[model samples]
Target: MSRHFETAPGLCEARDTATNAYVFNQTMLRIKDPERTLDFYTRVLGMTLVKKLPFPKMEFTLYFLAAIPDSQLEQWSKDDGERLAQTFGRPAMLELTYNWGDKDKAEVNYHNGNSEPKGFGHIGFAVPDLAAACARFDSLGVTYVKRPEDGKMNNIAFIQDPDGYWIEIFSPENLEQGLSEHLGSDQDQR
Candidate 1:
């Protein structure tokens, strides 16, 4: 019931264009509480707070976070200008935007994109150990959308952030093995 589409020839040939230097820097999410959201990302998820830019005039603040390794931590902490340069160069960084007065509001102002309207799907993070990671999330009182054993695809799990954003978790090995098994089953059925 699924159809596969090949890349158009013209688009495939456009790889030689000058856009090669472009890198996917980050994705932004609007959050209500900086304290709770920042704690969830930094303390629970173990991402480093790379930079914090406050726009008082705009009444919002930007927080950049990345899963930086220990070795690179010292370097990123050294200088402001260099830290920002390095942060911008990295891919898959998360930007959390907090409007100054949102914390005082009774209700969350933004949609997590997973409910009724359903536009943005979810963000993913590949873990080294799926079981252990899920356990850690459990101990930290994180909310779960799906547990690995709950669905047909048992290799993946989904956890929710403080702002109700879904984060898909999986191990690379398990994901590949799951795909292989599914494909083999499809072939066997044919």
Candidate 2:
């Protein structure tokens, strides 16, 4: 199967119909301590643990989490491999992998990709109210890479997980309003 689309005048772009059929499945992050990371994600961030795959022989475990209810995940778990694939055809999830004995050993730590030269930037979530979320994080003692009040980008803030990976937080309304106010004036010059 093929589709022909036009990029501009006299430009015929052809592509296989199956070429772009893709969906974001999951983002995997290595964790040093399962208990502490799980507590941070579940208790502080309000995410539900959907699935757990433990490979004792391989000496590692994979935990899939989402902002979904347990009942919904239970229903999805009833499906077989093929059925599950079909059902979750476009599922977006977070996978946390923990190596065995890392929690017991104090010297084990993963590079958070935010050192001298940054690699992976950050993952983001849009909250209902940014102020309330930051307040709750303060009470929970979550580490902040950039607090809303501490930076020039006051609309968006960055918080670090137990593993030192940054999670960007913002409210959709605030972000959009800020972007509109800032970017709207630039159109006049164009």
163 in model 1: Cα distance from truth in Å? 0.5
For all the candidates, what are their Cα RMSDs to the real structure? 4.5, 5.0
- Taking the tens digit of each residue's C-alpha lDDT, what string does model 2 give over 1-190? 3244323345546655786877777888999999999999999888877667799999999988777665565555554575346334636677899999888888988777889677887888889999999999999998999988775567888999999999999999888665565553434656
**Model 1, poorest ten-residue lDDT window?**
1-10
Q: Write the per-residue lDDT of candidate 1 for residues 101-122, one digit (tens) a residue.
A: 9899997567878888989878
Q: Which regions of candidate 1 fall more than 4 Å away from where they truly are?
A: 1-11, 183-190
lDDT of each: 0.87, 0.80
